[model samples]
Target: MKQVCLAILTALLALTVVSPASAQYIWLDKNNVKVYSDKAPPPDIPNNRVLKGPRGYKAKNIEVKYTDGTEPPAPEAKAASAPGTPKPPMTTAEKNAEFNKRRMEQAEKEKKAAQEEKNRQAKAENCERARAYHRALQTGQRISRTNASGGKDYMGDEERARETSKVEETLRECN
Candidate 1:
């Protein structure tokens, strides 16, 4: 009689071990808090945002909200999960790759900004040089340079006129 009773108890326990994936609902409310109940979650909650199924229903995807409502102070809001609940599945390698990608992008932006500053400085220097040349040409002083034969060659009318035009063009471009 004792053996028969033990066998029947074991059979009952075995029969009750498995439960169907129904009769429960798990979702996040507008406040980004998780709610678990036998009834359906709020209608504002999208189907994909449901964390668990109820009554033969399953969400096609599970999305964790990372922000408050839909308004943005940008990514200031963080996703809230229940204490002692399992966290999202993410591998270390994927996290490392993402970090490296952002680092590279930041470095690229710095490089481009530095290049623009360098170009701006170079333009300023060129403009200063052009202004100095224009001033010297307007002074009416006799300009001379070393000739190919190492003799001082004074400025002639035609050559002076040509140099004046070149300097004027440079001034225009720099200004």
Candidate 2:
């Protein structure tokens, strides 16, 4: 029983080491069915259709062996720097500048909200006026408007019809 357990552990360790290097490549065949394999597809397959395999966990130090028996080039090591040097702290002026920028952004947001609310109120008032005019025209009430010369002029039948159409258009737009 001990020997069997040991063998199973060894097999698991072997799989863990080999699985990452054997990440599968996937692509669609001519029939549009997905095909998966460890090796690259045939040269006839378009490069665009080939999907890259999932990335696997890599060890800090992994060695590659070439089948041609040639030694790989050595990697360059980075020089370590001294640890005592630290980043400079922010100045008071810098803090104030950041605070001012945030304040300006908040102010702009408040201004935009106020403007949108004002526009909504104006639209509501205009809609109410249009509805009132439509109701008056339907009731056949006398409709009059001040001309550019400041004289009260009663609307003729054609004028009333045009006004009714205009009010109807306004109502449709507002609603």
Candidate 3:
């Protein structure tokens, strides 16, 4: 643990000492936000748009061009990115954003799974009720119910048929 802490302190000291000695590029991003980096801005960015660049590397040397107005770059370049131009390591803010994005995606997946389980349970319940009602109708026994006026009423043949059809529809949907 002592060695680990010492190593971390040394690394941090090295980084702080190295960073200030490096040349930095400054420009406004597409969102019109000022950005500072250790790399040059995109080639297409206007020379005037580049607020600053490495020492002895004048920003006015840039030439803006758009090929899309005529033709696109070869697919090979897009498929196999140019070699030796490795992407820079992610910054702290970028790492945090990526972590948040993954976390939100996982949450969304869990939410969807929970909803599907709830729907499945509801469907099973509906199927069970429909099956029970179908069994009762098939018995052909007189089915009675209390009317809205609190009087006992019996189901007629037409009412039974209508109910059977409705239950059949519900069964079909549940299945």
By TM-score, who's the top model here? Answer: 3
Colliding residue pairs in candidate 3:
none
User: What Cα-based lDDT does every candidate model obtain?
Assistant: 0.76, 0.77, 0.83
lDDT of 1 by residue, 1-175 (tens): 9999999999988777644434478887655578877777666567866888755774444344656576433222333433444456569998999999999999999999999999999989998987887787788788899999999999987887888899888878876
- Candidate 2: list runs displaced more than 4 Å: 1-89, 147-151
The predicted structure with the larger lDDT, 2 or 3, is 3
lDDT of 1 at 15: 71
Across residues 13-79, which tens digit of lDDT does each residue of candidate 3 receive? 9999998777588987655678888888886566776888866865544433576675545646843
Model 3 is weakest, by summed lDDT over 10 consecutive residues, at 57-66
* Model 2, residue 70: C-alpha shift (Å): 22
Between prediction 1 and prediction 2, which has the larger TM-score?
A: 1
Candidate 3 residues lying further than 4 Å off, grouped into runs, are 1-84
Highest-scoring model, lDDT: 3
Considering summed lDDT, which 10 consecutive residues are worst modelled in model 2? 76-85
